[model samples]
Target: MASNQASNNTQQESKFTLSMNHDMEQQQICLDHQQVEEKEFDYSKRSQWLRAAVLGANDGLVSTASLMMGIGAVKKDIKVMILTGFAGLVAGACSMAIGEFVSVYSQLDIEVAQMKRDNKRSNKIKGNNEDEKNVLPNPAQAAAASALAFSVGAIVPLLAASFIRDYKVRIGAVVAAVTIALMVFGWLGAVLGKAPAIKSSARVLFGGWLAMAITYGLTKLIGSSGL
Candidate 1:
């Protein structure tokens, strides 16, 4: 009888041990799932900012380079080309900042309105919820980031043509530098957004080249025509 009792106790302990192990396994799975979800959310936020930066940089680089190329085609003076590029950089940066500010402000208003509606419908107090506030976009921050990115991109062509004295060489340098920067920006954007790197790079590179070519060709034609 005592032996039977001992065996029953052993069975109970074994079952308890199995149950604890199962619970632990379930907890581990839940934890891993939560971690994965958090990681993906973080990545999504990162991708958004990276994409914005890439767009701003690409705009700055292409516009400034095209302006320089156009001026070079007509004037052939390094000072004129540099000045044109600088003007374009400043104007583009300010434009980007203002545009981004307005766009994001509109978006922020829409989101805040939606959040307020949701809270009202759910009978929740409209408190200063940190989580809700954190998710909202800041117009000032967006504007600053956009301006900074545009300035950074616009400087590339300016620097590339700064030292070259020969008009032809300066144009070539600007083109080469803009091409490389476009490719890099495309690749970085693709990597962050999980897109095809080669395709993105090629598209950006060709677009930049086309813009510069068109600007140069048109300016040259106009200058030659004395129009």
Candidate 2:
């Protein structure tokens, strides 16, 4: 009987040990799941920085190329063309950085304000206990998007300048490239923003074409006026 009791005791101890091990395994699984969930949603700072850098480079390329091309169309010497391109590169980059910051800040401000207004409005309609949470964009995501957009917009022209030999060709290429990039970028932005891509693309293209027409018309005027 004592032997039988000892055997039962050993069996109970084994079962307890197994139960504890099972609980620990379950806890480990939960921890792993939580870690994955965090990773899936997290947008790293490096990603935003990289995006901003690319955008800046693209903008520098496109803007400098367009400016150089336009000036070259006026038959400016290489020295003058190079000077103008350099100036454009600096100015465009600064503009891109400032523009990105302002645009992002404004967007965020408006979003927050709108959310507050919405909450107030909802409260009036459905009472304070309706559990209406304000859904705002992830700050990191917004920063990444804005930085990437502006940097790319600026860098494209700068890179194009390296390939363009003549000022006029550079300008024309810059204009064409910028227009195309704007449309593509606009469409992408719209899609990301949950807007209709076709409408966004059309709007972006129209604006780009309009600007090009004006620039071209001005170039003609400069040529005709012998300026």
CA lDDT for candidate 2: 0.63
Instruction: List, residue by residue over 15-124, the lDDT tens digit for candidate 2.
Output: 99999999999999999999987765453534444445544544554455556556666655766766777777666655665676677678778876776787777655
**Segments in model 2 whose C-alpha atoms lie over 4 Å from true places:** 44-50, 69-76, 111-227
Which candidate gets the maximum lDDT versus the true structure? 1
Backbone clashes, each candidate:
0, 26
Q: lDDT tens digits, residues 1-227, model 1?
A: 99999999999999999999999999999999999999899889898899789989999999999999998888988888889999999999999999999999999999989988887788675465557898799999999999999999999999999999987788778988998999999998898888899999999999999999999999999999989
lDDT of candidate 1 vs native?
0.92
Cα lDDT for residue 224, model 1? Answer: 97
- Summed over model 1, clashes come to 0
Q: How close is candidate 2 to the true structure, as a TM-score?
A: 0.48
